[model samples]
Target: MRMLTYISVLFLAVLTVGCGGVSLPKEDIFSCEGFEIYPDSIVRGNRIYRAVSPREISNAWTLPDSTTVAPEFISTLPMADALFAKAVISPSFLTPEEIWLSLGFLRPEESMQALRSLAWLPENDNEDFPYSTLSPYWAAAAWEVYCATGSRTWLREAYDALTRMLSRQWKLNRSALSEFYCGIPRGVTEQSTFYPASMDEMSRFQTFSASVNIMRAYSLRIASRMAGELKLYAEREWEMEADKLAGAVNDCLWLPDLQRYGQYLYGDYYPIVSSVTDNEANLLAALTGTATPEMSAAMVGELPLIASGVPSVYPYVVNQTPLRPVVQALYGLSAAKVRNPRAFIHSMASVWNLSLDANYPSLWPSLVMKGLFGIETTPSGLEFRPMVPEVFGGEKQLRGLRYRDAVLDISLNGTGDRIASFMVDSVSTDSHSLPAGMKGHHKVVITLSGNDLNAKPLRIFEPVTVPPTPEVKWPTANDMKIVGHDRLLHYDIYLDGVMTQSISTDNYHVRPGECGVVTVVPTLERGSSGYATPPHVCLPDDEVISIHASSITPRRPPLHFIKDPATATNYIELAARHNTRITCYVNVAVEGDYFITVGYSNGSERCGIRTLGVNGVDVATLLFPPRRLNDWVHVYPSTTSVIHLNEGVNKLWLTYVGGTILFNKLTLLKRS
Candidate 1:
């Protein structure tokens, strides 16, 4: 049965070959696990269900109660009321069962019981897409309940609900399949939900997903331990289907050189290709036993770049860049080197800094307190791993680790693995024979010794002055600027209020009045050869900000590619070397709309628009290419095509075909 399941998985994976290729980080045994999920996703998912409570609002716009905390905050937060409420209320989609099923929760069942208030969703079925976005909870809540009680009734109900949901969304109406199938409007309505249908994506094509992947991955992992607890093991077909879905997902999303999976896939198209691979794909692939060697290798090698100690969609990956502290540790661990434990531990400590920068200081604290500092719930009591990273074998100081109500101060005697005795609030523990695992947020002190596993004597404390806190700012949204011949946007440096260096046109002196108005109309390259311009900074690294535009209004000007304008009147080239979002506006009144020709670079195989938002303002239109990048490179309009854009700003962002996009220019003209 296992062999059959594996074979089915491999076959389904072949389907994703059309999705594209990206280089994945080297495999970290710890990182591998199909349907691996982010802690934020669960927390965020729970928050969504709580936000839509009927008692809270009529439409989806009611303000949350300031005094009365929502279900999520109540349970997750450590306050008495919050804890009490979370223990009983059981929000619509949250349940102890599902919480227990989470990979992060050590005592899953206990955690579930702690947040019991969020047990089941309200029983409202069909109203007005009431559950349009909140549908994933059905599976989540059901899984939780089954895990808690091990009741056959719960299992059946959960299975039935999931199957129905799959049928409703993927089969019957086929809603939200891929951007190639249906292009929905963006904004509060679509952006509010995390569970984007394949339509809202470019990497997920003809694949089954949602909470199913997570549930199945956990089920397969725990089946051996649970024994006769759940019947999922008996259903071989379910396992087969799950494997198939995982295979298809990989085939459709994984990219080789880029080393990550697309956010989702479309019909032979992967659009909106962000530089970072989706973390969900990484985790999911690991759990499913379907991760390619290449994928694993890329992640393992690039561990230094991963900030959260896990891959995510945000913080992008750079080639050959120095690894972040935590990532470096994971990388070392992935390589299984005990000799370099200091580097790993020291890197782990530096993770605290990244936490501050990512605007989530509380998050890494949770990990450091629990995972690294060695706080966890194992079958054998609490375990603590206090190995700190040391780049070089030497004496070091540890400070400000809060355990319970006490603050801990410890000193390391040496660089290597020699156990030097140290005092924790006056009590001492040997550095060498530290306990196996530690619980989250516990104070301890010990002296470090020897470079190798050999123990050393206790040494004196060495404390460095605390560095001044640097001001951290979010990256600016206005990174790109478009300028015409008359209006040039350029970059200029102002030293002591006097404009000095400038980035363009001429070396002419600028009037002091026109100083700050200077912008860097960056000279964009057609190929990926030029050094990537550092994100435009408003200040030094202490308070740096990005210069990219977040959202552009009034729509971007239409770009027209010219192919010997004197000869080839209509034909122009469409190419780009990176993923770009281009929105074109057209004012046509004919029943047949204008033809926008999309072209790709040389090795590019697919390209398509990930989103199309139209207010139905464009009068008279036909043939919207539901699928742009596929077996072919260009899309032609059809008389019966539904590709109609509103009269005003028809926003569309084209991406590379199955590969990367290096769009040169757009070919715009009447359909004729």
Candidate 2:
């Protein structure tokens, strides 16, 4: 009976493989599990792209609460990259007509009802479209969509829209020396220097940017291709125009000193070569085939400057603004993958780490499919030329990949393996090519048995060293009492009466066996005004620590406490109309029973109510009785409250409930 059962199972396995029935792996090929942060999803017409939230309005010094404001619209570069990602994972989500329509909406005259908040309107509130520096990208995006879905109607419509926009709005400047149009808008290049995207602030004001010119050249080539596909009469004109621009960029922008294109052109004549190199421009030059072999090699050599896994200016110096931009990183990494896979993999890992820290959107999976897998959708069919990096382990298979109208299950066996034998639909072939214009589910089995995979990993970037800032001294605390100096900084209570941790509020409870030499440390530096040394004290296990509200740090709104003329002491004024809240950081070395005491003064005739919260959780409501006019004496309302605290960092917050109240200090006493 056992022999019969084994024989039956063996036959079933052979039957499944022979019949082109492929099984999917239990694990997803690109899973975000165990990652510190995952990219946020943006959905458009059933297609999703992992996108980073737009820069918070508050980051720009805008006063409106960010929580209430809608996130800014996705920019051109990120949107293009997202489209690419969508095409790779779910090709059906992107249609050439839809992509063209979306790009059209970017025009100011179009009805914004479809785009809503995603439309970019100029600050002047005029109907004039904000001139986009990235106008060429729309043409490139349309070309990609056309390549994925061969729709003549869609291509024609895209061609019309692109020609109208570029001819009327983005008119090329014809140079007297050359027949090619060499001019871009005056401020087109300025858009590249947006903060946290690129660090070319020094060249932000330059009228002519080398990178923008390269992109223009690339966009023209794509437009010419699309025109040829449609048999349009303007095909030759587009091609000639593209050729002229490419020639002019090489003639004017190329710098002998750096052996690469200069950052930008000053006054459209003098090429201003700065110390900083723009990686995005060089990468674009390589992708567009405008860079010479020597120039491409030089660009590859500078990969080390992209230390943060994304392209920032080379030889990154601290305190310099406009850090790494996600768009440059995505494009730069993609360009490097084909020329240098090892460097590409290393940078991918580094960028992944940064994404985790910043919660930035990622294009990793898309790059993996397009660059590593080398999947290109040609007019003929899906082309597969996988370039596996040495860092990749053994056999890998990507299943459930949607290509056009077909669902493909592709498996690659072994690392550093070339296609020894290729089988499509159980047919053996010497050439690893799939039939063009085939629809429906397809099974592809690739067997690779070549040289052993190279196990060594390449380190492409240098270590970044951060400069040290001035140290801040915190208030002192004894086992019996704790005193704070700055209301903007939090304190930690350490063992043995040594201030080990900082607490923001008096809401934390003390645990047993937490007593020792107590020490108080400030979480943030008060800059030059900070203490020369931290304050410390020794106290019994059941001693109490008192913290003044003035010692806690205030994070966002820029205001300082007002000094009392009589006492010569500072106190925070709550009379401002803006919403205000104070946070205190406290560390408890050991958890135990603790009591909290809040000192507040309300001089108004009406009683004031303030909400008390510990570690983001509302714990109690304290009321301040009306005091005599002009009275500023501190009073502890509703006796000290007992609350439990864990053995770690504790945050306490005092939020204004109603009425004006002046906070003085908080006291935390350990219970025996």
Candidate 3:
């Protein structure tokens, strides 16, 4: 692989590929602007390319390509590398997640952001969106923001906002599964709660989600601490409430034998982990203090991972990327020299043909300030204990990091947690901290002993039990009405294998027109019920037709090979390599009317992402995770997505963002 520089103020085109597979950059480097590069410096890979800064150097962040900020850094770290800066810093680059992550480095007001899905909201109303993003992680994110800023004013405001939020929007949802508790509902997923069903998102399934509840529990604990510091009266109440939820999480969801929490639970005490892989719920359980120390220790000994990055879920219902796992688990596992998240990201992008930026900038700063550097600010003072992973086995430096009224320049040599020497302004200090009242620019240097951290090894990535792919049972034609189990159970209605509606026994409905092949998968509070559905024509109450891949394909039965869009006008074709700025047409109907699935093959190590367009507008970034190809003879993987269709014919365009894909066919299911 070689570096091919495409000079642009905001974009840096860095491609890495070899005959064997994806090749990583020779070195992971994010250097300070003051670091000089000669007119033509030699590098690896034949030393054929000239090394030059992509932009002018400044006292601010020196990296030539990323956002120019007040801080300066020269890092050769793995996760917290040069590309981290490029994720988001400029207002134009702001994303919902990035704004939360930016609080450590940028001003709070500058980082205030609205949901990308809700970007249509009015500008004046944008400021309020942060408080109402419908996520269980809000309180924890606010705590991190305060940790980075050390602002009492922000803390007080955050505390007040959380109080009101808990009373109103942030309160736990009522649950039927647990008779005594209300908690974060199932499918609360990530920070956002709504999207066109593209990846079997948890949001599409409403149940009791352990990950969500654990976050809610953690938030309450943080809120309680904040209240005590501020002398608020609700500290005890919130703490007790947090304890209640945390207890419920362990009692109901913890899979003791598996050493992890189940993904979710049904209303009547059925855990859904029988056929599911453990995910963020466990990380949240361990990190949030929701789990006991014993439970956490057990988790450290177990927890499996995907072939590349740690996946969100295994035997994926759809394409998945382990973004949360990387952010929350990697640093926690620094003692074990766990896999680097950046390597997975690059490898995934190499297959997806898209380099994602501005989505996770804050994660880098969080991992650095709170994980590797281990900077914690309290009323007493500030403590700094670097816990660099073995992957970052070298010296790294950061300049102009603002905390309170001080601008700090810190350098760490060697890696791991063993500290050999600590010095502030060339003056050695016995303690690894600074006075709270100390307010001045200072240079601090630290050296590691290069010995073991003495910390318990974080032995994640242990093999988890893989349950059988429970058989899917489709509703028979004998009944238009769906029935639940004699015991408490529910049903998931799938249109063309894409789940559309989940109905409980009490509120079953059979809407005849707004569906395709009708199959009802019986969902128990405990185990899997393999379900099936078949293609059935519904008279177009609104001119809707059940669409097959044949609607746009020239062949039937067997999925025809997708030729280049340039030549195959009638067949379903996507853009191939050497063809940028190309748009291919797969005119289906309008959205809110169809669920789409694609049959594909990916033998790479990492997950790939592709954009799905509704009409001509891009609605979702779909993931295509790696599967065993056995040279295209083994697995023919498939993923489902929702596409709304109009009353008449609608042109759904799948743009060739980049890279070549092995997608063969598109399956459309009519959706409500």
Reference-based lDDT, each prediction: 0.32, 0.46, 0.48
Per-residue error (Å), model 2, residue 601: 57
**In the order shown, what is each candidate's alpha-carbon RMSD?**
23.3, 23.8, 18.8
A best-first ranking of the candidates according to their TM-score comes to: 3, 2, 1
Per-residue CA lDDT of model 2 for 1-672, tens digit only, reads 334333433443354357564322222112221221112322222222233223221111112243321112122223222333332222123322223322221111221222222222232211111223335446655665555556566677767766755554332231122223323333233443321122222223223557667777877787788788888878889888888878877887776655666554432112222323456666667766777766775555544343335444443333433445343444434444334655555445444434332423224443445555555555556666665654444555555555546667776654443667788878877767665566898877767654553323433444332221113232333223333344565545444323345565532334435533333333443211111122122345346565665476552221332244433233444443643577787777668655565666656655454556776687654444445555655553322345556678888776765566566677675543
The residue-by-residue lDDT of candidate 3 on 307-358, one tens digit each, is: 3334555334334443442433332432122223333222222211111222
- Report the C-alpha lDDT of model 1 over 434-459, residue by residue, as the tens digit: 23233343334444544453222211
Best by lDDT: 3
Against the correct fold, how does model 3 do in TM-score? 0.53
* TM-score of each model, paired residue for residue: 0.34, 0.47, 0.53
- State how far residue 248 of model 1 sits from its true place (Å): 1.4
Model 1 segments beyond 4 Å from truth? 1-110, 113-119, 123-228, 231-233, 267-276, 287-294, 303-672
Superposed by TM-score, candidate 3 places the C-alpha of residue 164 at a distance from the truth, in angstroms, of 1.6
Compared with the true structure, the alpha-carbon lDDT of candidate 1 equals 0.32
The TM-score of predicted model 1 comes to 0.34
411 in model 1: Cα distance from truth in Å?
18
Ten contiguous residues with the weakest lDDT in model 1: 36-45
Which scores better on TM-score, 1 or 2? 2
